[model samples]
Target: MKPVENAEGIQASLTLSYIQATVLKAKATLTVGILNGAPINIGIVGQADVVSDGKEGSAGLVHTDLLMQYDIQNDQFDAFLKATVKVIIAEAKVPIWLYFGANTPIPIGETAAEQKTRQSQNSNFDYYLYVGCPDGNGASRLGDAFSKVKVTIWKMDAGIVSGSLYGEAYFCIGSILPKFPPLPDEINKFLGYSTQSSNENSVINMINQGGSASGFMFGALVHGNINVDLAVIRAYAKATVGFDVALLHVTNPGSCQVGTSFGMNNWYAVGQVFAYFAMGVDLHIDVGLFSGNVTLAKLQVGAAIKAGLPNPTWMNGRIKIVGEALGGMVHVNKSMKFEIGEVCVPEMDPLASIKLIAEVGPGTDNVSVFAKPYVIFNLPMDNKPFKFNVMDKEGHETTRTFRFKVDHYTVKSEDNGYVGQGTKQFSADGYTMTLWSDEAFREKMKYTITIHCKAEELINNNWQKPAGKSEEEESIAFTTGIAPDTISERHVVISYPINGQNYFLKNEFKGKKSMVVVDQRNDKYFKLENDSNPIKKLTIIEADGGQVINTNFSVNGNDILFDLPGSLKNSTTYRMYFSIESSKTQEIKTTTELVDLEKTAGTGTVSMADVDFSTVSINTSVNILGASGSGNAIQSPTTTSASERGIRNKAKQEQSHRDAIDRFRKGETPVMTVINEGIENGTVDPTKIQDGTTAQGKEVAVYQPATGRIIYQMILEPVNLTPSPIKWLPLEVS
Candidate 1:
């Protein structure tokens, strides 16, 4: 071999000429340290062929040689170099005689010509490889011939190594020399085969920079009763680098075309290099979760039916709906949806499609070996993915697109089911994949996520076994939307009129009679009978400033009502409140209640199941308008005078008309009767009678200021009286 310089000009080389092919025996000519003497080159030149046996095939040059460089001042062949030409494996760490041969230090300032003359015309041992232009300019074996010189060597299975063995005087110069070589097949594979993709900063290369062989195997794993048919090996580097991967089939295992033998004997089926940036995701699957299917990530290996061969028939393919999230983790406990042939592997740059690798070790029920997959890195971005529509919770469906990251990432449910059991999965960061199946999808929302996966598993290995789900997880934060709306309707008193007056109290409810609001909008609010019921607030107050409300009120259909304890006072005012709420934004939150007042106050208390209140009351009295006739007065002067509070004499009655009014307003319908028993036959005067009905429906009393008399009355309705619209019939009036 010709001598070569490293990055630094330290140079060394060894030439071997093979004499026998069968045993790989050859003659090796070793040379070193020609740079030390400059024009006066100095080093060893063994003219005789050194017979070495290691000169071919894999372990080239299995031999060693010790060559020494001489320094006249140190005088005893101070520096030495030993080369172990090659080894069987790529790496070896045996100690060799790499330092100088002796610890002798020579004095500076000695030049080769000066040293030669100073040592007497003939020094012990001096040599020359070639004669230069003149006597002093020959390739001489004199270390001091030149200062600051370097020597380097190169060989197979090891890389370039350089350093120097140099010296100097007042001009103290240093030497550095490192030997260089053909790096092992394991080392410079990238420089040999790796390259950049079209995309910016993208690269494709092998992963086993420390391994001796090429090509990888993809296989499936089987558990007790399940066949883990899906798995993916991918390449992902730090940032922005993606891959355009392909499966190069090797008829025989070895480097593509390393040895000349490969070019002649090995057959390779080069596949299509797909779009880039695809990666493998860790989907944790297990048989314990019978509801969900397994994938290439973490899934329990199912038991196998067929154990041997290229791949077992037992490995099952699982169909799953995998989600593609941003670079961060996403919890997958969402509704499961599916679209065949859809793959969802989120990446820096997703691929246009995914392809699976072939089986290498075949599937085994009991995995005996650990998997060591080749993970390539620094790939480029890829082609356009298949786009389709996906539905959101808002009932809006939008189109999405995906690409292939791994060529062999196929997994389907038909082949990878859990004993025919199905499931809904819930996975979030910070949590393991838990399969939750609502055989009925009970509380789960029905949603579908589009999945894009490769047609097969992409790996080549002898072993595939189940991996437990990762407990190390991350949390996916979510903002809960508004709770499902549940509000039936709200009711308000639009206009409640009594005695020809209107009370438009929406939030306020005040009325003497039952308010029957007959409208088409009765049941406007949602009752949400299927959902949880919400609490409602109601407040009713009388003009006397007393609260009147009770839970005992009954709800008929959708109408809300509270039975009043007593009638509202004639001129008194009252207030009412109605409020209800369900969700944050779904309810009768704001309203108004206005009441028109007509009042005269007297307080009275009423009781109920949940409320107690005092209400206003009105009193009425009747008196004689004219003096009793003298003849009739003297004749009737037998009992008592009119000095008593009511009259000259009081007569008892079953119940007064005021009592009837109170009963009717208290959620009751009262009917009253009146009998005429005042002077029916003797001296009947028209002036002595009073009307029982008044302008406000009916009257309860009559008064005569001339005699300070009061005639009691019975509450009456229009229908109970004669045709004059609440006209009362009386015997006569004086």
Candidate 2:
């Protein structure tokens, strides 16, 4: 075979026909023959026989073994073959025109319709890479290359005679090179193509590149901290490309597995497989899916009963429990049928099954009342309302106020409980809670109180229903005594200023001027039987002069106190007159002595015998007969006329003096009489009471009745007397 002179390619097409009667056989083979040397056989072609009928020809089979040594680099055959095909038929050489060319369309025996239909199917030429050359060359290996062959069959043009056949073959070198162990970049790209390939590096890269892996794909991130297997990734890269090249060569050989399953796309599964290989442990991550059931592991409550005072400071109580741990459990199951985002609200109805119950006391047990009682609880979770059902004697009350305190952290509601009123809401450690009744119990009344809660509805603590009963209860019964009002005045008596005692006027008393005082003792209450102030008014009198000393009543009704004048004498004897309710004006006599530091040192130990003010008189001898010559003179008369009128005037003055002294001794002082008369006439102020006339209101003239002449006119101004400190000298009543 050879090329035609000036022809662009080899012979356009090749066709052969034989008209034999019954059996026609054909065979073709190629041998390279040197110019003057023996022919060298490179390949073989087996004979093909045809059995034809007298009417038409029948197709036959021809088997051939052939190899064309070619250099793809130069687009020509090897030097020994000289880019030609020498075919010898039946040992008698037969000339065959075969050419390798630039552009040529091989032809085959098929109609235009058949060719169009096949073309419409979009078929591709089958390719083959012979591992070992048919001429006994070695097989291919890694990084090795020969040539790639593409064989295609097509029909000739109808104008060129239909049903005529031709064959086409394509060749390229090094394009079919075999390279094993894919590069890391190629492996990364393959992994990035699928979300399931969540190797730590692959997942992070994908995520950084704005790709996502959801569901079980991200489970590894939470389960094992995003563990990945580099070896598995390497193997996957190699196996994937190897299989693809094998399929290109039309063969499929079993390969190694990527861990256990081919679904390496599941990150959790991949992590599990890697985990097993690294540590021999299979991981089962929760993946934020729960079975939607919680069990009650433990339940404990406070005492069933408690006794309290009429107005107890605090009532011990509790509603505590424990349950199964619900860690990392999501609201939905793995199947993802439904999703609940809102938490269940706790029950807050006061009359509901879960509440604190305060039963009614005596006299109206049949009625129901809702009182706003105060309560405390040790609920360490949410700060939600804790309801209570209060059944008082009457049917009218508000919901209870509850304060939940946990670990010293107090969550007070809009209204505070009794626990907030100076008492502890929670225990020292903030676990126990003490409740208090809103109001003091009625006197001598029977009452009962109970606390209850439903464990299942405790959503604040994430508590759910258990298999059995979930309601917890505690109760207590007690009867109250007489009301606090009555008890306040019982067992109390006045214990100050004994009937007959002597007291000293201490210098300190001048500052306070509060002489009469009620005793500060539990048994010395100053309240009247009707709970009113016992003291109506107080009156103090100079015992020697029988003159009343006005006093002021204490403003505080709970105490019996009196404010005396600030002008009291040190060595005077005084009498306290108390006008008390349901009693007479009681009188207590007390003699006062000047404050003696030594004698007063022992408080409440001063005796009347210690100071003798009555027997020691600084009068007669000292005033009338002493050497001082300050003698007592006769009382002066009202007036005088001539020389002898002096004696008569003196006699009248003495008579006037005698009459005045007599009247004063008989409980009628001249000033007192005048003041009383003026008071009766509504002309003088009754509040002013003084012996010496100064100026209280309008001046009145004094008349010398013995001489029938008007004397001097004067006014009176009262003076505040300092009180003497009265020390109680309790003595035997007998």
563 Cα displacement, candidate 2 (Å): 3.8
Q: What is the C-alpha RMSD of each candidate to the true structure, in Å?
A: 42.2, 51.6
Which one wins on TM-score?
Answer: 2
Residue 342 Cα positional deviation in candidate 1, in Å, after optimal superposition = 31
lDDT of 1 by residue, 319-368 (tens): 22223333334423222222222111111111211111111110111111
**Poorest lDDT segment (10 consecutive residues) of candidate 1:** 304-313
lDDT of each: 0.25, 0.27
Clashes of each: 116, 19
**Residue 703 displacement (Å), model 2:** 70
Model 1 misplacement above 4 A: 1-400, 403-539, 543-734
Per-model TM values vs. the true structure: 0.14, 0.17
